[model samples]
Every structure is written in C-alpha cells, then in structure tokens.
Target: MVLPTRQNVEKVLEHFNRKDGVIVVKGKELRERDDTDVEVDFRQESSFYYLTGVAEPGFYVVIDVATKRIQLFAPPVNPDDVVWMGYPDSLETLQTKYDVDEALYTTDLDARLKEASAVYTIPHFNLTFKDEAIKSASTEDNDALYAAISEARIVKADWEIEVMRKANKISSDAHVKVMEAAKTGINEAELYAIFLNESNRNGAFFQSYMPIFGAGMNAATLHYNKNNATIENATDMILVDAGCEYNYYASDITRTFPVGGKFTEEAATIYSIVLDMQKACFAELKAGAKWEDIHTVALEVAAEGLIKTGIIVGEKQELLDKDVVAAFFPHGIGHMIGIDVHDVPKYCTSVERIDRPSYRYLRMRRTLAAGNVVTVEPGIYFCEFMIDPVVKAEETKKYINVDILNKYKSVGGVRIEDNLVVTEDGYVNLTTAPKEIAEIEALMAEASSKKRKLE
Candidate 1:
C-alpha cells in the first residue's frame, strides 16, 4: 500500500519553514555478514521511510524545499548481478508504486544535486555516493531538516495509528501464547521460541527489539535477554517484555505472571502493585497532559503499594521525597512508542528534564498531545542491586523493614506495559493481553485444561 507520505513531506516542509534548500536522505543498503556474502536483514531507516514510503535498499529521497516536490532515486540495475538477484522494479513502476513526484536512477542523482540551490539532510546521515554539492551543503540546515522530520513524526496520521494498533494486537496474541505454554521446568528458550513462532506465523517476521524472557530472580534485572534458564520453581514469576513489528510499526508490551498457572500470595501482591502503577499512569494520560506528571503518578502508586506491603514503612510523601520509591521502581514509567521502540524527539532542547532521582532516566519530558502513541510501563523489582543503595544510605535507612524485604525477594520483579494512543479526552489502549489477576489466572487455567485433554 502507498502510505500517505507525500502529505508527510508537506508536514515536514511546514515545520522546516525554509524554501532555500533541498532535503536529502539515503535509505539503508544491503550489507554482508563479516567476510561472508550472506545478507544481514535490512530495515529502512525510520527517518527515510517517513519521507518516502520506500522500504527497498539503495535508494535516496530528495525534496525541493520551495516547490515541495519529492524525487526518489534508485540503484541502477546490473544485468550480470540480476541473474542471481533478479531484476528490480522499473523506474516507471517505482514512480507509480510509491508516493513520489518522480523516480530516477542513481546515475542522474549527482547532476540533480549539482543543479539544486543547496541540499539539506539529517546531520551526519551518510549518502550512498560522494558529491561536491552535498558536502558543501552540510551545515545547520541539516540539523534543521532533522528537527523538521522528527516534529512531523511525533503525531501519527490515522493510517499510522491503525498500523500500530494492528502491531499491538499481533504481539498481544503472541504474549498469550507464551503465558499459556509456561509451566514449571519449562526452559526460557522454549518460551522465547514460542513467541517468535506465533508472531511469524501471523506474518510479523521482525521483532521490535530483542525479546526478554526473564524468569525468577532473573526478572529483577531489567533488559535481561539471557533466556536460557529453566523455570525450576513453581512459585516463581516470569516477565516477558517483547513485541513484533507489523509493517515497520512497533508494539512494546510487557506482562509478568506466575511460572505455573496460578500466582502465589506474595507474587500476587507484587503483581497487583505494578498493575496499579500502570492504571494510575493511564488515568493521567491525555492531550496537554504533562509527561513528568504521569511518571510521578506511577511513582506515587508504587510508594503507596510498597508501604501497604510493609516492605517500607514511612509517610507516602516522605518516601517519595527521599527517593525511596525509586529504588524499587528504578526505570522511567515509559516513553513514546512508534517507528522505533523508543521513538525520537521525545526530548527537545527546549524542554529541560527534571534532575531528581525519579526523573533522571525518563525518556520523555514533553507535554502529551492528541494523535501521540506511547507506552505506559510501570515496574517494581525486588532487585538487591537497586535496594542496596537505599538501605546503605543514612537518611533513608529508617524506612526499610529488612525482614519484610527478604520475605518478598523470592517474588523477583513484576511489570505491566501497554501501548496507548493519546486522545483529546483520554487514551485508547491497544493491548489485548489479559492483565487482571483473575483474567490471567483463568486464561492460563484454560490452557492447562486443554493440554490435559490433548494428553
């Protein structure tokens, strides 16, 4: 399908507000693995795809700033190489297939570049070919072009939003597959394979990022990917933070549940706290909403829950003021989600970030707007690495109940994440995975019953 990318060009032009130069960026080219000829997977640069909807390799896009006309340049087909690689689309076909005003071969690109008033590109974006005009045009104009494209990408068009929603649905179903198949003695590798198979069979061959399949104490480490351990204990929890890319759009959803079908009491308490954190953040998400405030809401919920569990004893405000809650919930709540999992331009030079403990790691500091898509992920970890600092601190030492913390250490970590599209009134949650305590238990139980019947 031809994406409405010509309108995207117009949006960038509107943001750039410059008519003196031409915008240029190159698409990614096929590359080999080390010395071998085997092709590494190719993904078009997100910024380039935003301008011209072409996903193929060895192409470049140039847009005239004054006239707002788009020109796409393709690699010249080689007859000898075509014997093995097959012929690519003809220039005429490319012009008709993509949303560009003109399509030409790379042979004609340098001449056109020489003829332009000046060229502007995303700063430091490597061109496929060398040209005197391109080198001369590298200046702050390139930075300006980068900013223009990022600004345009922040708000999704209706079609982009739909693609992202489909991505979320596809990945959400994959999460259910993982949840249903999880059991004691199951290898994390097997669960990882199950998720990949489910997503691939549904036509999503590319994962948004490396899949995390941490179980038991492994879950305490955020961004864990050594999914090689066995689920040795029935009392343990599994945290799967994975998603597949549907047509270049991304879905990032994280779910934590019992390794066995049912959560133990201690695991249930921690899981509920993380779920509550996500819900509280969801309540504060909408157009004109402050992103830092949403993050703070997650922190507040985490503080209250930890206190209720008796792991930390102190007033809520004091716990937050002393940064005690951040020890358990170390990461930011979430960030903008789109083409890349952690989408660009979330922080601009105009927006200064909060320097406090809770705000240091936040990926975004801008005001939320309608048509923006983001993830609301909140987590609480029983990780010693995070808690040791708080325990050692003189001022924060009084709040912790060491015996209580040790009791829940076996619970590891719990996190819940969902993709949502911000609207004027509120947000639309695209994730379909079962997250409520009873809902997750019922789903897993049903799967176990089916397995028994098959046996």
Candidate 2:
C-alpha cells in the first residue's frame, strides 16, 4: 500500500492546483542497494508514494491546475508481466483504492502534458522526465515542482509522526533482539542478523538505512556498517545503531552494550557518562530550544564526566573552552528523521550560522519546534586519530591524562540515542526499547537458559 488515501492526494493536488502550473508526479523504481545489482525493487517513490497509495514502479500522476482533474499513467498489466515478475495488482484496484480521478497507460502522459497549462515535476533525479516534458511543451510554466513538496515535508504532520513512532518502535525492538542474541564465539554479522529478523517480524517494510553492527574499536568508527568481526565476550563491546523505515518514515537509534551479558567497570563508566549526557540534552528539548544549545551542554557534561574518570584533568570549563571535548565527541548530537534518515529537505541550506565550533557539520540546526521530530544521541568515542593528536599536541599536553587513558585503549566507545518529537510543552520520546543493563542481561540469560534446556 504505497499510495496515500484520496484525501491525502487531494491535499497535494489542491496545493499544486492553487498555483499557476500543474503538478506532474513521476513514480520511479527502487534499484537494489548493492552497487553490483541494478535490479528494481518495485517500490514507489517516497514523495509520490506519500501522495498516492500506488507502490508499483514505472507510474506517473498528473494534476491539471487549469482544468482541476487528476490522471494516473501506468502500464496495463499483460501476460508477459505475469510470466516474468508475476501478476501485478490490477491498476483498476489501485485507482479505486487511492480514489484518484482516472487511470491510463504510459502512452498517454505526453498527450496529457500537451493539453495542460504547465507541467511541474520533481527536481534533481527527475532529469529524464523534466527534459521530456520541456521538449513536449514550449510553455513557460513547465518548471520545477520540488520546492513546494520539499517545503510541505519540512514540518511533519501528526500522522507522519505516528508512522515514525511505529518505525522507531520496531527498530528499538530489533536492538533488544541483538542484545539478547550476542554472545562469545558468534560473528558480529550473526548477532546483527537477530536485529534483521526481528525488524522483519515487526512489519518493518524497509530498512531506513544500512544497519551499523560493529564491535569493540569498530564502534569508534562513526559509520561502521561492516558486521564481519567476531564478538568476543571477554573484553569487546558491541554497538548496534540501526533503524527500519515504514511507509517511508525512518527511525534512527543507537545502543551500546557489553558482549558478555554484563558491562565491565571500564565500559560501564564510559557508558554511564554518555547516558547522562544524553539525559541532560533531553532536559533542554522543549519547543524553541536551539540544538546547538543542547549540544553545548552535552559536551560540557562529557568534559565533566571525563574529568571525574581521570580521562582528562583540569577545570571542566577550561577544557571545554579549549575545545578538548570535541576530540572525543566529534559528530553532532543528532539529525532530523523522517522519510529520509537525514530528512532536511534542503540538505544544503544557507541557514543562520550557529555559534557552535563546527557549525557546518551540524546536520539539524533549526530550533526545536512543535510537530518537528529529531534525535538526541550523545556519544563518547575513543578514536585513535582524535585522541592521538591531542595526546602528542604541545598545547593540550598539560590537560592529557595519558597514563589513565592508555589503560583502556580498547574500551572502544559509548553511544545512547533515542528519537524525540517536540511538543507544545516539552517533548515525547518515540523510542520504546529496553536500555538498562539489568533488562539486557535478563533477556540474554533467559535465551541462554532456554537453549540449554533445548539441548
């Protein structure tokens, strides 16, 4: 069910019709994720899928503003299609299901455009369609339709938020499965498979993105997607950061846990610090709060925590002022999550400059507003490149706790992430997964006991 309801399509059609030009939404096929495979997944385009409920690829819908009529362009299924990819759900069913005006074959799109005032298609990737429309019509109104739809998706509606909540719930549950399935002698990919299976079980229609299933120092790498490493219960820690997308809405989550069913004191200390920092960030997540404000506070908390653990010495303010904390917490606190994981419509915006040190790197810099969803993820990673330069730097040498830091070089990293939605008063956390050490240990223990009984 890729197409939205008739009312939803009307909402978009009305928005387009109100303008001078007509809106032409072209549906595209989803290519395989792998670089080697060009096979189509037959999933509908996200924006088009949002407006219309049709999921099959190679379809287009046009709303004529001047005449106020809607038309769908798709290939009529034939015996050949049945012989290849199997029988497609009938186009008549799709039309009635989505409640659109009319359905026609692909051959009619050009003729319809010639009769319409202006053809408004999506931007960037719609190059082929855009060129075709331009060639077919000499009318000046045939222009880009990207801005309006992009603007519409910027502030989420309540329904979109609900869908994201569902995705987040499924993703969080998958993380729990990984926590229970991880054990000594198992490969990281095998442990990650638990998450994949659970996500599929929970109706995760598609993975929001590639799952990051890294263990030990691999966790230190920010975007570690390779799950080939082994999970040794002795000293390794596993970081599973992943999510599932439902109805084009995405959820981003990260939870790090000990591989041996219990966190070592070393891992616990770092984990607790990151956890507390995330909590502090949540406290400041009310409407109108700047993300940079939350990020600044999290860094201060991380610096203070590190001082207490002897990872760094000297006044917290002094260390933070010198930007020493940036060495450990490199990335932004979080980003906007929706149809795309990084859901900012204008990926490259000339927005107001934030006062943060690395303002450009901050993905989501807008102030928290009502109906806007974001993530609060604070992490402390011991990356070799980040820490090594600081330890050997002449200016930062005084603040370095080389002896204590060297003791746990393999302790890896700690990250705790949860999806949040800003409300009128404070905020709502969409993630509903187990995070406490006790809860994770109990689940793993129960699974192991069950395995023993089965044996």
Candidate 3:
C-alpha cells in the first residue's frame, strides 16, 4: 500500500516552526552505471521518501509550511524514453499514486522555488536551480531543518511501525532459512545465497545492509561482510547479521549460532551471556529511560558474565572504569532504526557523545520515549585486534586472563539483536527469529533430518 505520507509532511511542517517560507525536498534521480548506459538500481533517499512516498526517481516535494500543502513534482515524460521504457506514470497518476495535493512537471519546480520567500532544503540535498528568493540559509538553518525532520521521524506513526514490522518478519524468516541450511563444509557464500533467496522469494529485493555470513573467527570482526569463508568445524559459531527493507521502512537484526546445529560448551556459555545482556537491557527499556543507562546495563552484564567465565579478573566497576570491558563489547549497545538503517540526529536531546572509549559510538544520547523504535544488540567479540591493545597496555592488562581468553576465543563472537518499538510501559519486539539455543538446534536438526532422508 502507498504510505499516507501527507501526515509525515504535516509533521515536518510542525517541526520546521516557520510559516513564512517553503520547505523544499529533492527526491533521488535516476543514474546509470559508471561508463555504461545500464541503469543502476534505484533507492529513494529516506528523507525524500518520508515526505513524498514516491519511489520512482527524479521527483521533488514542495511543502508550504503555512498552509500545509504538499505538491509533488515529477520528471517530464519523454516520448523517446517512453519508447524504450514503456509509458511513464502520468501527472494525474503520480498525484493519485503518491496522494499529493498537486502533481506538476519539473518545469514548475523552478517557478515554485522562484516564488518562495526563501527555499529551505535539508542537509545533503542539492538544488540545481537558482533564484533571488533563494537566499542562502546559514549552516545552522539547514541543520535545524534536518534536525527537525529527524525529530519528526524519531517517533513513527502507526503505519510506519506496521511497515517496519513487516520488514522484520521477512528478515527473521530469512535468518531462519540461513540457520537451517548452514552446516560444516559449506562455504559462507552458500549460506549468504540462502539468505538472499529467502528475502527475494518473499518479494523483498534489497537487504537493509550487507549480509555478514561470518563463520568462526570471522564473527569477531564487527563489520565483517566478506561472506566467503568455509566452515571447517561444525561447532564453530556463524554470525549472520542481516535484514531487509520493506516499503522504505527498515529492520536490523543479528543472530549467531553453531553450524553443527548444537552449540559447544564454550559457545553456549558466551551465547547465554550475550542473551542475558539483551534481557537486562530490555528490562531497563521504557519511556523516560536514559539511552546510555540502558547501554550501561549491557556493559554491566557483559562484565559480570566475563568475570564468571574467568576471562576477566576484576570487579565490574574497576573493569568498566579502566575501559577493560570495552575491549570485548566495543560498539554501542544499539541505535534508532527506521527508513535509513542509521537513521539520524542520531538525535534525541542535542547532547554530545560521552567521548570516552566505552561510549564513543553511542548513536543516540537522549532519553527513551514512547513511539521510538530501536535495536537492542549487545555483543561480546574475541577479535585479537580489538583486545590486544588493552592486553598490551600496562594499566588494563591485569583484567584479561590470557589463558582463559584463548580457551573461548575459538567461539569467536556472539551477537544477539532484535528490533523493538518503545511504548509508555516498555517495548514491543518486532524480530521473531528464534534466538534460544534449543529452538535453533531443534530447527536445524529437523532440517538436517529432512536432508538425510532425501539423500
């Protein structure tokens, strides 16, 4: 269904807080492959999609902040292009399809811009036409508009939430597919193909981001997406971090499990600890809960788990204070998820990052509120690159038990992630992939049995 984007436009207008000027938004334009005529795949810019809900390229949205009128401008149809690319959507069709008040050709956009008291476009939006009425807005003005739009998106409308849920469902099922198909002797590339087939068969053509089909040591690399390794050990954990975008809304999910369908003793211990971290973070989630405080809950859980496992040798506070724990759980706990995976201001309260090594990548720094959708992804990685600096350091080396750390390093890394929509009381989980050890092992075993019977 076409999103009812007028309400989104209204929200942007309310946030812009100015009635005298027109807010201009540029949509994505069609492009071709470098040095070739082959057209590139088209994906609309998130902000433009939020405003117009028009996925086709070469579109523009002009919103009159005063009257709340939204007009969509479409690329003028060319008969020559139509001969190659079928008849384009007519102006009337564009109007009805996008549910815009007025639909005009690009010919009218310059005139509209020329007539505006001042044209305001969000950051990173380029305006090709020039007019005296287009007085240069200060950097702060553009940033303000960008921030205002981001604030509008921070709390999704009901329809937006539903779209995101649909995306999560597709992605969750895809993860299950990858899980059931994985086994020793299979290349990560094959499993990655399974994930793509699942998403495609379900009508989702694009993944929210690159899929990471990291096996064994590969999982320790946080941004690993090589997806090319072969699983030599059945018990080594494979981390699959992927999701698909549905109708512009996005879902981000991560799941890690053993290729053999049963986790090793060490694997289960680490996996359970990460799961506990997620649960603790969830308990702290709700309106008015501070983002960093929820993150702290994950860090605390990680510290306790590491100590229990004998990988670290210190009290939790001292370990956290000395940044020893950050080596294992280096990234931020989670971030806002929406049309764009890394949806911005990354914004909540205009607060800056804590800048400490532990809080360096905290994406959102504001207190949680109802209607906010976020991911609760807390992980523990054993990548030597991330850990050795601390081990080599004179101050932090005492906390890590090198012998014990090596014993579990083969487990590599484990990350558990889920999408959640915040409510007044708490959050509603949108991810449905089975994260429980028994559930995963059972499903994979069932799948393996079917394959054995077929063989």
- Winning model by lDDT: 1
**Alpha-carbon TM-score of each model against the true structure:** 0.98, 0.87, 0.98
The TM-score obtained by model 2 is 0.87
- Supply the TM-score for candidate 1: 0.98
Alpha carbon lDDT of residue 256, candidate 3? Answer: 97
Q: Which lDDT tens digits does candidate 3 get at residues 145-173?
A: 88889988888999999999999999999
lDDT of 2 by residue, 357-444 (tens): 4344567566677877888888988898988887888998788788888765677877889999988788899998777767766877
**CA lDDT, candidate 3, residue 6:** 88
Global lDDT of each candidate: 0.89, 0.76, 0.89
Q: CA shift at 221, candidate 2, in angstroms?
A: 0.8
Per-residue lDDT tens digits of candidate 1, residues 180-221?
Answer: 999999999999999999999998999999999999999999
